[model samples]
Target: MPRVRALSGPKPRDAPEPSHPMPRHLRTLTALLRRAETVTLLAVLCVAGGLWAFAALAAEMLEGDLHVFDETLLMALRRAGDPARPIGGPHLEIVMRDITALGGITVLTLVTISAMVYLVLRRQRASALFLAVAVLGGQVLSRIAKAGFARPRPDLVPHGVDVTSASFPSGHSMMAAVTYLTLAVMLARQEPAWPIRAFFVVVAALLAISVGLSRVYLGVHWPSDVLAGWALGAAWALLVWLVARWMGRRGGIEPDRARPE
Candidate 1:
């Protein structure tokens, strides 16, 4: 009885190690990546919508359903007493001529060439190449659109400027949006401040819009034509921007923030 001892219970297995929480920085990065993906998806959807809208408009125009609307807008810009003259006086005509020139091949090419040179000198070769592709591709697309639709220029009023191409989409309007918007985005990337970026974008939009309006005011293009040009041009620019961003993130191109000094 003196040596009687109680048996000890069997020991329990050790608990599995607690899983470690993800580091805060890693979590933040993951969230940012997710947000970027969401933004890209939205951008793609918008591009599709813009394309669909252009197609629908083109179809309607081909069917002659848009003639009334197009004619009304075109005629509205002309003087009531004289359809041969635009609503504005001769002075205004001169101003519009100057504005329209901003979107012409000469001016657009000069701007694009200058931008490319600057980007190249800054060691942003990828961006420079992309810019060249975007502008040149836009030109090709504009030509194709004109050939495909082959809509004649409005004859309801005297043209403010000489034009010979099919007029479903205004070349000046489309190229203006492409050139100005592309330049704006490239410039915005160099700025860290949101306000500065917004300013650049607004200015670009204004320039594009004014060019489109000038085309209509000059009686060279129908309102629908200008609208179609704007929609398609904006979509193309946005598509290029998305591609550039995606490439940058994948290390195919340098990030804007990491530009060489």
Candidate 2:
């Protein structure tokens, strides 16, 4: 019996363990990316809807249907006897002129160039290029819109400033929105604080609004023109931002790294 001990079977090697689950950080990043994508999509849809609504209004205006509305608004900004005098008096006219310049080609171009140079100096080449393209493309688009609509500047009131361009969509208003919003987004991305980001966005919006209103007050653009500009410009800026964000996530552009507390 002692010599009859059975030989022990060789031990089976431990089965290779299943691959580890994805890292927690990676999972978090994936979830954040999905959320960002959803938000971007929703924003784009809303922008498109706004642009469509504004475009419809512009079309009505071009058909001479919004004449009364546009004339009423333009006339209201002037004195009863004098179309030359805006409601806010001489000093206010000066102020409005100054504000309107913020959206002018020269001013906006300088701002864009300055921002681009700053980004380049920061080594944000992609961001600089993104900004340049957004602004230049906006300029081109504004020109095309003007040519396509071929609407005339308002004759209901006297002009506060000299303007010579088609007026279905105010180039000043649209460019203001495109430039300010794009710049604001670029600046805000550098900061991590929500309040700071909101401030940048709010300021940009206010500037765009003021510029559009100036055009109306000056009687160079109809209300619908400004509205259309705001809509289209906003849509363009948002579209550009979404593209940049997607590219950054894919490592095609520089990431906006989280700021240290």
lDDT of 1 by residue, 158-226 (tens): 787889889988899999988888887776766667678779889988999999999999988999999
Error of 1 at 138 (Å): 0.6
Clashes of each: 0, 0
**Clashing residue pairs in candidate 1, if any?**
none
Candidate 2 per-residue C-alpha lDDT over 1-261 given as tens digits, one digit per residue, 9 for 90 to 100: 368877889987799879999998898889877977797889889778867976798779867898888788888899998887789888988889999999999999999999899889988898888889888998998999989998888886778899888997889999999999988888777668868987988999999999999999888999989988998899888877777777877987677654433
TM-score, prediction 2: 0.85
Q: What is the TM-score of each candidate against the true structure?
A: 0.86, 0.85
Error in Å for residue 50 of model 2 = 3.0
